[model samples]
Target: MRTKSPWLLFAAIFGASFLCWKLALEPHARSSGELERAPATAQVDVPPAPRATAPARADATPSAAPTEHALPPSKQRVRVVVRLAADASAVAALGAELLRVDERGREHAVACCNDPLAPAPVGPRELAELLRAQRALPEQREATQRFELAEGGRYAIAWHAWRHVPGTLTWRTARGAGEVFELRSPFTCEERTLELVIAPEQLSLDPALDAPVIDAVTHVTAKDG
Candidate 1:
């Protein structure tokens, strides 16, 4: 066999090594370029989180409807004339209070009329103040004069008689409805009469029978004939 030349053998080995390095390096460079150029994965649009909401309440109360109505004109009036009488032997003066009573039995004083002997004007504000003061001083005197009644509702006539001696007083409506009250000397006698007045749209009581009549025991007199 002929011996191979040393130079030729060396040259062959060097060429093979260079070829292997080129192949390995070229693949690595290509892989790096591919990574740099690859489009960034489309940023997935993350939807915003939903907002929190409050739950509806189960026990909320509904608003109430108004219960007040307009009052009728003053020209359409329910005249309430009052008369008082007593024994000729006695001297007396009578004052009256008109009240509105609701279905619930709550009393609202609507008007007050004083006898000519003790005259004073009592309005809604004055009556309210008197009532408040009465809680603190039950014996306080409240002065009042005649007032107009406009609205129709259940009403009451409270009469007070000032007399010189202890006695009894009688109260009656023109319709024959009546009540009695006891009087004390030096102090006033008080009585109440309840009556219903129909609305303007309905039949009303006879105007002639709409007055209140009061009578007292002997020795006492009434200012109003």
Candidate 2:
């Protein structure tokens, strides 16, 4: 066993210290190179866009127009008066009413025959013709007759024409002709006792006055031979 010298031990320790110092210096050099590189930039804020209120449209519905005729009533009553012209005139002259009232709450008239249940026309031509024929009838003549006023004497004219000619009649608000008639008759009788009365306003018993021509012909058909 030879004793080791202090100098040899010192040399060995110095070699180990040098190796640790080299390893520490290499890492510090790498960190210094990274720091020298470019620094990162900061980010900026941006606002969003606004949205639209109304979008593209495809289809839509339009409003409708108003009507002229009155709606059908729940309860309705029609009255007709047939009067010979003479009687109707007499009633009008005396300032007396043309309608008459009965005990059972029914109205009667001699000057004007009241038909409470008049029918309605199918179409415009039919309506005009109905009105034209009705107006031309003797009903108006009797409405002006008689000179006495009594109860149940409220009279009105109404008619229901079923048939109509295609090319014969037409109707317009201003001045066009058609077969549609506004079946509105005057009311002037009020008698409870009389069961039935036929007071056509006028008696146009003249044969010369041909049947008021409608569409160059009459609506009714001729009797078969």
- Judging by TM-score against the true structure, name the best candidate: 1
lDDT of 1 at 204: 18
Off by over 4 Å in 1: 1-79, 85-91, 112-146, 165-225
Residues 1-225 of candidate 2 have per-residue lDDT tens digits of: 235666668767997777887877754457878867654422111111122122211111111222233542222122222232233221110112223333454543323232222122322233333454544451233222222222222332211112111222322111001111122222222211111122221211222232245456535656643
> Distance from true position, residue 175, model 1, in Å?
20
170 Cα displacement, candidate 2 (Å): 31
Candidate 1, 1-225: lDDT as tens digits: 236677678868998878888877754457767766633221111122222132211111112222333642342122223333221111122234454567787655553343332233632233333334433443212223454444445555443322211122221221111121121122111121222221111111232333243563356458646
* TM-scores of the models, in the order given: 0.25, 0.15
Candidate 2: residue 141 lDDT (0-100): 30
- Residue 144's lDDT in candidate 1: 30
**Candidate 2 ranges beyond 4 A from true positions:** 1-73, 85-201, 209-225
Collision count of model 2 = 73
The 10 consecutive residues of candidate 2 with the worst lDDT sum are: 172-181
Query: Lowest summed-lDDT stretch of 10 residues in model 1?
Result: 54-63
